[model samples]
Target chain A: EAGVTQSPTHLIKTRGQQATLRCSPISGHTSVYWYQQALGLGLQFLLWYDEGEERNRGNFPPRFSGRQFPNYSSELNVNALELEDSALYLCASSLGASGGYNEQFFGPGTRLTVL
Target chain B: AQTVTQSQPEMSVQEAETVTLSCTYDTSENNYYLFWYKQPPSRQMILVIRQEAYKQQNATENRFSVNFQKAAKSFSLKISDSQLGDTAMYFCAFTTMEYGNKLVFGAGTILRVKS
Candidate 1:
């Protein structure tokens, strides 16, 4: 299996700008998860998309939003990016949203640097 | 709402030795899922192990194992016979029974392995 794959390994944007990160889930996976890992911090849940619907979102502001496509791929968009937004954004995929039993596979992640 | 905590910010261990990372989460849900993820310098998040709250047996994956205490809300990861490649940032996460739930992650612990 190829596992999960993300695009544009690195992205740079200025403060107040917008950034878009893309991810392709593993084959046969129907759930995609977005997470943000700021320097020296853990992975913070951003959003969860399954079956082309926004299932859940994190405590992050509305500026952090994303969607899942028909193919189960996902895109994470950060609007009004702040310097603190510089971090690694990861995408993970699972068979479904059935709690712990659903094994999740992650991608290399897109490193967004907000200047 | 749930919160995960990793008390150790950083830890180092010599090759062939063992190291344990601590994690604790608070949640009101009776059933949930917990996981440990490893993010290497390449920034790829890999699922290290998982433990279901309802299951008393600890989850293990080869050299990686977890000590899960449901009542205490504690889940710790122990790596036996660690190698230099074990260096990475380890994060503990939680997911509740609520449909389409998002993961709650800890601050993470940085593990460094030395030869």
Candidate 2:
């Protein structure tokens, strides 16, 4: 079975530009999660989608947003990106709705570099 | 607000040896979950192990085991007979028992296994 798949393994953008990262969850998974790994901040939760509904988000700004599709695919959008936005963006999927025991399977992540 | 803290920024262990990484988290909620994830050079975030807050028994997977101390709010991972393939960034995360599985991650520790 193919694990979660993310698009544009690497992305480079400039300040004020908009960047979109995509993710396709594992088959039969209904939950997709997005996270940001900044240089010193480690992995911070960005957004979460379950059954094509926006569930919860982290402390990120409003510009940091995403949506889940009918197929359980997800897209993370960062508008007006800044240099601080350069980080590794990860996508994870799980079988259940809540609880951490569901075993979230992660993608290879999208390395976003903002100049 | 929940927060996870990994005191070790980097760790080194000789091949075939054992190493432990420490992590602590702060949460007001009594019921929650904790996890340890590994991100290799390929940058795939993989779940190493997970411990439920209510479970007294520590969670283990293969050579990976967690020392979970609920009273101290501490969770540490021990990798036995480490291998070169174990070289990666290890992150500790926490999540509440909410509807959406939102994760709070720490500043990861980079583990290097020397042959």
Candidate 3:
């Protein structure tokens, strides 16, 4: 089966602009997760979407929001992007919330560069 | 809230040698999950190994293994017969049922395997 896939391997946006990154989960997966790996902040959880609902989110600001489609694909939108928002945004997927032990497979992250 | 810490910011190992990356986590939840992810220059996050907090046995995958200490709240990754391909950024992560699918990740350790 194909692993998680992300679009726009690289994205460039100016400060105060908006950016949209997309992710496609693996076949048969129902849970999608978004994470941000900033320069020195490490990998931080951004959002979790399962069964088309937002389950949980990290301490990130409301400007960092996303949604999951019925097909389990997800899109992360950043409004009023800032220089600190430049990072590698990664997407991961698992079986679902029921399978807590299921491993999450990740995508080749989308590198967002905000100037 | 849960937090994961990787103390070693950078490390190096010779080919065919063994190297261990240390991680410590703080969580009150009795049941949770720990993971080790590897990201090469390609920037694709790969699951290296996983350990369930309730499991007494450490998890091993090929040359990669984890030494999990529940009481001490320590989870370390040990790579045996290290290879050049193993050079990458290694991250330690934690998650609990209460947190849903949100993963708390460490600052990450950059491991360079040399020939």
Worst 10 residues of 2 chain A by lDDT: A95-104
Top model number, TM-score: 3
Off-target runs (Cα >4 Å) in candidate 1 are A98-101
User: In candidate 1, what are the lDDT values of residues B26-81, reduced to their tens digit?
Assistant: 98888989999888888878888888888999999999999998889899999999
Task: Provide the TM-score, chain A, model 1.
Answer: 0.94
Q: In order, what fnat does every candidate score?
A: 0.89, 0.89, 0.89
Model 2 lDDT, residue B72, Cα: 97
Please give the ranking of all candidate structures by DockQ, highest first, separated by commas: 3, 2, 1
After superposition of all CA atoms, the RMSD between model 1 and the true structure is 1.8
Model 3 preserves the real interface contacts to a fraction of 0.89
lDDT of 2: 0.91
lDDT of 2 by residue, B10-62 (tens): 99999999999999999888888899989898888888998889999999999
Candidate 1 clashing pairs? none
What's the DockQ of model 3?
0.85
Model 1 interface RMSD, in angstroms? 2.1
Better of 1 and 3 by lDDT: 3
Docking class for candidate 2: medium
Q: In model 3, how well does chain A match by TM-score?
A: 0.97
What lDDT score goes with residue B104 in model 2?
84
Q: Evaluated with lDDT, which candidate comes out highest?
A: 3
